[model samples]
Target chain A: MSGRAIVVTSGKGGVGKTTATANIGLGLASQGKKVVLIDGDIGLRNLDLILGVENRVVYNIVDVVSGRCQPRQALVKDKRISSLFLMPASQIDEKDAINTDQMRDLSAQLKEEFDFVLIDCPAGIEQGFRNTVAAADEAIVVTTPDVSPVRDADRVIGLLQSSLGEPQLIINRMSMDMVKRGDMLDQQDVLDILAVRLLGIVPEDEAVVIAGNKGAPVVLNGGSPSGDAYGRIARRILGEDVPIPELNGHNSLAKRLGRILFGR
Target chain B: MTLTELIQRIQHSFGKGGSKDEAKSRLLLVLQDDRLGLTAEEKEALRQDILEAIRKHLKIDAEGFTMEFVSSPTDQNKMHVSAPVQVGRGPANFSK
Candidate 1:
């Protein structure tokens, strides 16, 4: 059977749709599944950079759509994972350079060869977003715990309900300390408003930024909490009942006692 | 009788006390159905209409009470009317 196409999108910018796409692709690929990550951001593409395959890009999705190269020639295989491949977007081109039909055809072609096809969608509910979602079987929406992000996510959810169907939600960059201090919105509060099934929650880890800067996804680094969370998300996608990770810092009994005594 | 007095008389009849929560919940339900921006005068009319409507449906006496209208974030064009129908009490102390 053909593989499933899943689009990672967010109505607001800086919500980590790209990061989630990269990490999830890596996670799935690590499980011995053939995965293809598509850079649907088009003109402002960064999936290639994040996956650390930027320099090897001989052709992009536009090249395949315009018949300059076949789909196989456009796919850049990741150095670390044999099962994972990336279809990077062209930075110099405009958003209108590629159409939805092309994306649909490309995704259909990829589905034949891979076990999973993940599209990294751009922010905003515009033509670019439309193009990315056109060929997908399902969608994964990424949002932060801030009110603005949640509000934007609600709008996106409404749109998805009207356009696609019920899209799963992923809460990204959640800070447990802020939530404990009542300074940030909690997961339940977001779920109450959105009313969608929770797929995963990624904590606010500094390692994510460092990994992005290094052009390496944190999912490959076993020590990173966010990496482990991404790994669990991948397993969940593969039909494994993986429990969601707890975001609070793990403290020993001595530390807890010390905090209670000192009121720290 | 005044609308406030009628509501109070109804509240007094339902003597099971603690009618404040019931009244608030009932008014919220009605306001949800109204789906319009109800003004103070409109709200007063609604209060009377609701009491009369309830009276026609059931048997009860209402006393000292008030009905307030608020806004809902989900449906911006509608008003949420909350009526605290006090029954058989000195006064229905609605916080707001």
Candidate 2:
């Protein structure tokens, strides 16, 4: 059977679609699945950098689509996992270099060879957005706890639903302390807006930033709380029955907020 | 803003996973308030205006939901709108 192609997308910028893509792709490969990570952001590509393979990128996705290189030649392998490969996007080329038809065909080709194909989509519902969505079997919408990100995520989910069906949600960079203080929206709040299945909720951990700076994903540190969160998400993707634990310890404070949401 | 004040500002019953019907209901709550002090007919106009804005904001067609304003016996200044939001697809509505 051909593998599944899932796109990591967010309509809003800087919501960590690329970061989640790298981690989840690596996480899946660590499970002994052959995974291929595609940087579908075109001109503003960063998946290569997040995977710490930027220095290794020579041929990109555009090179493959434009028929300049075959898929095998464009593949950048990472030794971190058993068999994880990357298809970097062109940095100098524009978004116009690729379209939905080409992407759809390319994804079908990749799926035949890998166990999983993950595309890190660009922000906004433009050409790059449509191109990534065109090839996916399902989608993962990433969002932060703020208003604008939620709003834009809602917009993206709506688009994905019309084309790709309902997309699972990943609530990233959540501040449990703020949620306890009633300052930031909790996972339930975001689920309220999108009404999508909650895939996983990743808490705000500074270790994520430190790991990113060192060109490593937090999920590599099985002991880190944030890594634990992504690991759960990855297992969930493989159809493991994983329960989302209550992230904030002081549930006492948000108790009132939860009750009020239910009733008097 | 003070942490308490910020919390108070955001402490609305907006998120708790259920259905899109919840969003339509919440949108109605956010659309109109008695502070505007418009007449019933004027309030309906404002409601329609806000509905248009919501459709544009969500990038969805108007058919995503339906809304109607209902009369409230207790508060003359307040109007209640009940809405049922339906996604395009069924249980596949969450992920397909």
Candidate 3:
């Protein structure tokens, strides 16, 4: 079967789009699903660093697009999962240097070989963003439970709907304590503004930073809560009915959160 | 307001961000003056009625539009509905 191409994008930066893409690609590949992660943020690429494969990159997407190498040759295989691969972006400042038609053709070719192709989009709705989303069959908009992110997400969602399709929402960096105290915007507050299907909600986890710093995905860590969350997201991506684990900063604030977020 | 005025109101609402193809339409239709004390069914009817009125007024096709009556994101007394021109068709598949 041809794989699905998904672009992970958020209008605003620093909302965990790269982390989520890396983890999702890693998680899917770990389950024996062939996956390839693409970093579409040219000149400011970081998906390779997050995947712990930066040092192994010889040719990048730029190389592949420029006909310097084949798409398969440019892919750097992940040591942890044989089925997972990373296609790094170029380091040059020319974001529009790569041919968009070539990128789309590369995505089409990648879709034939891999079961899932994840593209980590650059922040903001610019050329790089257009390049990232040009070939995606679906989109996932990551946002924090805040007013500004939600507002930006709404604008992004509106744009995606006009072209790509119905983009799903993923709430990242959720602090349950803040939600319980009503200090922050809860899931309902986000859904209230951006009307979209709820994909998965990842709790605010410090392990993300530590793992990224160490050049490893936290999903491989058995004791990591965010790892478990990513695993569930990956399984759900595979059409599994995995129940979302109610993770918070510590204890069981889920029942109250269910009432608050879903109005149950 | 009368139904004709209400339809004009809905048209005016969609005209705010009315960009050609790039900026799809979003409408925030609020029903004021509930002093009529309409029943729940009546209120629901009016909501659907307004949607039909807008569709008829706007001359939109069937497949490319979606109108949702949602609780207002800001004003308590208002309802919001964003009608972006739907592009692709199929169930949403969310990736990690």
By DockQ, the best candidate is 2
Question: How many angstroms is the interface RMSD of candidate 3?
Answer: 18.0
* TM-score for each model: 0.74, 0.74, 0.71
Every model's DockQ? 0.04, 0.05, 0.04
Q: TM-scores of the first chain across all predictions?
A: 0.93, 0.93, 0.92
lDDT of 3: 0.75
Which TM-score values does chain B get in all models? 0.31, 0.29, 0.30
Q: Candidate 2, residues A2-113: lDDT per residue as tens digits?
A: 9999999989999889889988988888888899999998988788887888888889999999999999999999967759999999999988799889999999999999
Docking class of 2: incorrect
Question: Any runs in candidate 2 off by more than 4 Å, and if so which?
Answer: A248-264, B1-96
Model 1, span A135-222: residue lDDT tens: 7988999999775676677677777887679999999998866554334555665675567888999989999999999989999999
The digit string of per-residue lDDT tens for model 1 on B1-96 reads 577655543333322122333433443444333434356687678788876765554434456334444433354334333433434556543323
